[model samples]
Target: FVFADVIGQIVELTPIEVVSANGKETHKLTVELRNEKDERLPMVLWGNFATDVSDAIQGRGENAIICVLRFGKIKVWKYERSVLNAYNVSDVELNPLTPEVEAFASLLSSVYIVMCTIAAIESDMGCYYLSCKVCSKKVLNVPNDNIDEQGDEDEMGFHYYCVKCKVKNPRLMPRYKLHLVVLDNPGNSKFLLFDAIAMQILNRPCNELTGSNFEEMQDPEDILLALKDLV
Candidate 1:
């Protein structure tokens, strides 16, 4: 009958969509929240509460979503696992000016970066992908019968929440998904790059890699292009 506050990082979140319940269609959301100890659990947000979470900064188009849900109801799935079901009384914040976020920031900025040169396209793979424009993570696709004015099956109507940025986006975009082989001289390693870096290397979007441009070697030319600059 009641719920309390909990702080955790979102692990995975599905797209918000309208579902047929009883005799009507209604909006709903499911999110996986993880805590400092790496424990994760799912939380469901319903109606406007779900809508509000989807529209939040962390739930918006930010490439990643990272935030907290301070209150809600605890829901049990299958009478075994318990999940938090957010209600109208629940309050959600993105990058809230709280001690949890502050601690996360310090750990986030502590990562180190290294420089290396492209040696070879050892394992050239996917050149394009559809991902959350904000967090750049893969967006989940859930089918719903809810039709839009365009009768488009309302595919674009799904709001996908990102755990890294704690935001949600209604749409997905084509992005680069590349794996490059690099070396810092005498040492070789596999390096992965995402949309932003790939765009910079090719000076083109992921959609440009047409079948006509693809070679037997599988995007060797794309590798050549990256060599022009230190990628």
Candidate 2:
């Protein structure tokens, strides 16, 4: 009964107020969708039938393809309907090509640079710490005071905590200088913005690539020139 380009990921699924044909106020089960371009669209379900359909698509994560009926116009371009109004579900697939999907994935992998002095490296055990451009604080082993309080001293040592900020400091404290540069294939001249994680990886304090040390290279033809400068 309804047909329009479905957009957005399912953000919330619940009941919302609707105005019927006779101008009477009614409640209908609805699903909210945010399209690839970040537009919001709502689908509504009417009567008791909305229950089963609502349950089916309720908790579906973002980027799901759904089908719903177009009952009545809510505004100039938007329509009001519910899951019960849905007679069918289309692809129901999550596409990786979407901007939202790509952004989210990149964000998860991107390193968070804290205060030009510390970079939080993502690791299996949690975030591994590294030194910053302007400081000498290394990710060091420390006593887990919290676990120590529970009499678990054996689990202590080698924990990834900043020696400069101290364990008691707030997590938002900036401890490292971070920058990124995107490498296209080898021998290519173009470079892109460096992500936070890439900056952290580059900040590993190699003998030749130490903090701002790359700046000393006199000739543009030097090997260090290949190091993408992402500022």
Question: Which of the numbered candidates is closest to the native, going by highest lDDT?
Answer: 1
Best by TM-score: 1
Residues 173-196, model 2: lDDT tens digits = 122222222233342221122223
Please report, in order, the local distance difference test score of every candidate based on alpha carbons: 0.59, 0.38
Which regions in candidate 1 have their CA more than 4 angstroms from the true location? 57-65, 79-82, 100-231
Model 1 score (lDDT): 0.59
Scanning candidate 2 in windows of ten residues, the lowest lDDT window is 119-128
